[model samples]
Target chain A: MAKHSFSLSPLSSFILPRGDTLFYLIALFSILSLLIHHLSPVSAESRHFEGFDADEIDDFGDSDEPISAAKHIPPPPPTTTLSVSDPIESHHGPPPPSADPTSQVTSQPSDPKPASTSFEVWDEDEFEGIPQSPPSDSPLITESDTAASAESDPSLKLEPESEPESPKSISSYTVEIVCVSFLIMFVINYFTGKKENEKLALAWASKFATKDSIFDKNFSLLGVGETDDSPLLLKEGQNVFKFYASGRRFCQGLLATMELKSRHDLISRLYNMVVPCKDEITFEVYMNDDAMDHVVVAVAKKKLAKTMQKETTDLQRFASLVSPPSGKKWIAEELAVVAESKEVAGDMLNETVLDQVFGDKAYEKFGKGFISMHFSDQHLGSHKKMLVFKFALPDAKNMADMTRLVALVPYYIDLIGRYKLSSHARTKTDGARMKVAQEIYKELQNARQEALQRKKAEQRKKGEEAEAKLSAEALRKKEAKERARQMKKAMPKMKMTRTG
Target chain B: MSSPANDPRQPSTAKPYKPSPVAPQDLPIDYSGFIAVICGVFGAMFRYKICSWLAIIFSAQSLANMRNMENDLKQISMAMMFGIMGLMTNYLGVGPRGSKKT
Candidate 1:
């Protein structure tokens, strides 16, 4: 096989050697890390907020006074731990009343220790100090001072809030890793697959190129090397019609149009005639690439003739044979009336005249530039089949093309027969009943011999009369010879006297 | 020489041609994928926690099946992404009664 110089670049060579497994491994690892990050519970500094029930929040919202007011308030300062520790005094103190009368009303009536404890964790410094209960007298004064101080300095507490957002950063990083790995794997698979496919295609192209084999006639035919987009030109003078190629599909289509008992028999017969065991035959429909004019026929086989016949009959049962009877009758009457008028003028109503004046009638049934021919059993009795071919011409009416096609039909039949015989021979089944091909050949031989004997008998009949005439003429010639001999003897005496 | 498998009692005809031009009611629909898409929609639009969880599970199962499928990876991945987004919408309470509205 010829070698192609196609090659990958050095960069691709480096990556190609690593193979796709490595990329998949990386992707697998990335997915695993993402899963771990999503599934595993990291110790979130902001706390899991365990026991923070939605129902409890709903209950709080419904409680009306303190809870509704608390829902509006921002989370209290970390220093609120001091205020919470001094809860006994703070709840009753003037600061609570000044802060919100509603909070004092609800907090004073309900237990306030748990709510204050929940708010104490806002600052790490206060979280440790929470264990140590300080004196309420000093803490109460400091708590009020710190609340005012904390309100003035909220930025000092922002550090703890930022610390709890670590999990968000990790999740974003995991998302980025998963996306990048997925992209990398996708690109590697796509390009690697594409490259391998291209290499395989190149290998196949090289093999076909080296072998000088025809993949299909649509690609190349005759001596005309196909340009990428050049049109085929088949003309009469430069190139003649010949067999180009054949295959199963062509034979199947051809067989479909023929009135054969079974597809099996038709195929077997065609196999015998064309290439043995091959089901199609391709005749060169074009002459040469440069030919200005050529004829091509594309045979499109429809349903089997038997099925078509059944369908047509079924359709006929639905209505009269002359469908739309009134309109058809009117058209027939018009044609007849026109015919009468032409006849009265002694003008001819022949096909040529009608075709010239009223356009071709054949075209009305078969469509424009079409000719239909039916091959009867007499022509194809060897196969015991009939075929109808509808030929569409591209040019003016030419009988020569039809004649050529008819001439080729017998050759195809004979070719199919030979093909079948060869196949049967290969199978070594000579004991099988004589095939149609052998029968046809025997009949042809017998007919030829009979015709030869008949010609010889007529020649013999004429030869007998010629023989009798020749015999009588010979007898007369003998008599003339005897008479001449006697006259010669008598003449010798007269000669002697004359000489003396 | 006929076998019992070709018994006369059975219907003689083979199965009707699939992919026929006539009624194609036999065509299989991906019910799992359909459910997932519905759940995803409900979760995103209404922030229904149950719907979001259902969508997540269905989409995960679909994604697992898609690994075995030789084609349409991109489409299945997009569905998985939508499922993820729906889950997030429910988790973050991003709906008509979400934190933003409050």
Candidate 2:
């Protein structure tokens, strides 16, 4: 390798050693000077050649070393081993899907290279403009060892070797420059771009409403919810809303819709999905950095569908019930309530009657206009098992949170379910079942309420009965004594009258 | 090829040719100088960490009285400020051989 580095070494070897050393010293100082030049600083530094001193310059000049140390380097992308990797499905430069453990797809990794550095065999005819081979099988110069004479120039023809020193560098200045440039360019290309979370947020917003493709010729989004069987609807008059045109939320039109079953379900899903703390939190917790944020869009879709179905039915009922029949409107209204609530029972398992009937309107009114919409506060006897509707006063912010403080909605809904079980404890309406539910609620409230007082009054009734029994016994004894005294007085009066 | 012999053993027949100064040539330089040059180049980079670490240790009074000083220079921010100061000191003004600041 050392013999092969230089072409001029042999021609210069015949010169006097003393004179040769002078030329060598010039080369050495040239390299040391370049070294000092290289260390000054990278970018906008103020100093220039300030690190150089007299002794350093003299020391560099004294050495008889070569100035031809600049090595040859390959072009930009020093060794661009490009192999067209399989073009996997990409959504605008697909995420380096490796980071997302839940995601299945992967970014096409660059072509793999053998993880070793060793001698590479090149084809004999591969060197383009090189020399001819010598007589005794000079083609296969397997190793670096070369002892050919002046008549032969091995590969590139003209050069004969001289130095018997180790090859410290590749010694090709052009190649070195090209390789360094390539490496620097590669490093620069690795860094300027959008963060991963931003891209995910945009993609998620796009896929929020419809299950559609981001980019592809071969694509289809299959609808999963609407099938042969539909879930039970549990609300009478819920308006449906949908998000469309990616990131643009407007109430301009009705495109798709459904009604929610248990309001508790919405709150439950929210609690389950969002990391819960002292209080239930919203999506704004992560804010812009919400990459793992999966929007609970399926719940919204179902609620909207329910709303559309109810509105169409209501329109028909309103027209029919308007004829001569007076009670017809009331009947139609009742049927709508039942049908809407039945929608809930159709889907949910271990179905509770209280949630199906009043879950939709539990937090509805301030207990005005529609009192039966919630059963948690009222005694079961007066309200009975039925679905009710509130006028949806003041237009609650979303489908559920105005009158419905989302935090309080579920507990009230759960209480209604418990209230139903306690109210139905008895087959007959002996008031015991209702009475028990009232007792439980009073216990839950820990307040001296009317319902609690009523139970206390019932308890006092038993005590009064026991007291009355004791008083009756005492009164009988007093009456007997009075009768005996009267009899004695009457007998005395009769005797005295006879004597007279 | 046109040079005459300088010896006068037989007959001094020709003019002696002065040997052209042996052509100024190059020699191989080792990798040690390149290594030294890179070390010197990067030695300036380590000062940032040193100054920042030292600021945390020495100037604790300013750090302790951070809340009272409303000028936004405190432990955390001051450490970062010191780093920038060190880097600027290295870049612009020459001080001691390895001084963080001039």
Candidate 3:
């Protein structure tokens, strides 16, 4: 103990007032540690747990040159020094140097060089990597770039070391701020990306985007491409034109749209590929999916109208044809046959067999009338009556029945005029019905002509008829009076005798 | 593990050895260095811009129809989409929605 006290150097030669104070604190603590070490039980027993360490054993050797640390305890100021240098090597330096480099005027060297050695002590400054950064503009910033420098190395998991003054106190408030800022940035970026991606996907899907490119292609290529875009159109068109003359027809509405579109079987594969030509093609675009139904309906409507028109024109021609010179023999033969067979059957009369004998429409008209005789006697006596032949439409309200009866009126009239002038179908049915209907028609025509002629004569005779009648009446009356007077004269003797 | 040479209580030095500057378990971080890392990663991903850019080029039907001399084009768009998605997912440590958990 005496030797130790004698060997103690005056580290006050180097220590500042504050440094000396901390130095004595360390010395006092070290002495207390030594006294505790020797005076306490020597054995490693229950009092000392696993982490407990003794520094008294290190007193002589570890305290060798750094007499400032000769007490075998590090001063607080030196531990706090911020150096870019390594701590362990610097802590082994001369007595006052290893003690405290932290107090700006007290312990740190005035020259930054040898102090640079003491600066190395900061390498041993054990922070949890939470640094104390001075203002960035400070020249001390250069001291922080070092790869292994104590002030330079970031010891925490998050945040840049440039934020050393960022409050090493590690408050809950600071941590929360960092987390919230990070979360806000993440959320903002996420929504922006999501919305733009959705728009891009939609714009990509729209088909007019490519339709401009599909132009100028050939029919088959266009068909294939069209089917590639939409298979429904091809399948529909093929179903309609059963005997499709056109190669690779692109017509839609030719087939069943709804049914086939649902069936994706392998067999429909070939039909699926047919597409339309890209040019001015005849296909009408239907908004509805049932493309084939409307196509057939449009075609049928056109055909029915055409047939009706043709039939009307043919009947007109046949009416005048019966008067032709060549029509004589045929008309006679048809008239004889109809008279023999009371009812001409079926559309047989409407057909051209006996029509060659009579003219066609006239035969059809007459035969149809004979078939519709049921309602022909509606004005008969009150007794309900039955006809000789039973008709399917007993009422004659059947369009066929009505057409037949009404048609006979003109037909028979026409036939008689022809028969009177020539020999066309004067058979009993035709001749009899024709004669009666002819007589009626002639009487009607004569009456109509006479009435019309009478009207004309009335215009000529307005004054003449009245004057002629008046003159005749006047002459007769004059003659009668003259006779009366002559008689009286001739009978004068009788009159005298009568007077006598 | 008990070595007399490493006994802290019987430290042979003239002075007690201060513990190492820091505990061994703590990582050595250079927070300034991470600023460059953040910039580099963001720049690379931004420049990669693979999906948006390639889609625009293909017009969303973004087919890479590389034709042979005979002019036969091959379809490789689907595979490219998967590859790009895989790269993005790996960096994020996750998989896409509706993917089977294998």
Q: DockQ of all candidates, in order? A: 0.03, 0.01, 0.01
**Model with the higher lDDT, candidate 1 or 2:** 1
As for lDDT, the candidate ahead, 1 or 3, is: 1
lDDT of 2 by residue, A1-500 (tens): 00011235433542543564556546446644543454445432424323344444433333333321211111223233322223475677744434323222222222222112211333434444443222121222111222334235544322222233344465634543553464354333222211121222232223322232221111111111222121111111111111111111110111111221112222222444675422111111111111111111001122332453344332122111111124221211222221212222222112232233323343133222221121111112322221122222222222233222221222322222333222332233335335556867887787657678989999999888876777777879978999999988887444335554
lDDT of each: 0.34, 0.29, 0.28
RMSD of each: 36.5, 42.5, 49.0
**lDDT for each residue of candidate 3 in B1-102, tens digit (9 for 90 to 100):** 111132111112112111123332343332212322333233233533333223222221112112111111111322233333323433332223231111
Worst 10 residues of 3 chain A by lDDT: A291-300
Off by over 4 Å in 1: A1-164, A167-176, A209-211, A214-500, B1-102
State the weakest 10-residue window (summed lDDT) of model 2 chain A: A246-255
Model 3: how far residue A267 lies from native, Å: 33
Q: State the local distance difference test value for candidate 2.
A: 0.29
Query: Sorted on lDDT, highest at the top, how do the candidates line up?
Result: 1, 2, 3
Best candidate, lDDT-wise?
1
Clashes in each model (backbone N, CA, C under 3 Å)? Answer: 9, 25, 30
Query: True contacts preserved, each candidate?
Result: 0.00, 0.00, 0.00
Q: Which stretches of candidate 3 lie over 4 Å from their true place?
A: A1-500, B1-60, B63-73, B86-102
Summarize candidate 2's per-residue lDDT along B3-52 as a digit string, tens digits: 12331111122112111222223222322223323333343345443333
Please give, for residues A4-27, the per-residue lDDT of candidate 3 as tens digits: 012123344325436545664564
> Tens-digit lDDT track for model 1 on A444-478?
99999999999999999898877667877787987
After TM-score superposition, what is the CA distance of residue A96 in candidate 3 from its true location, in Å?
A: 19
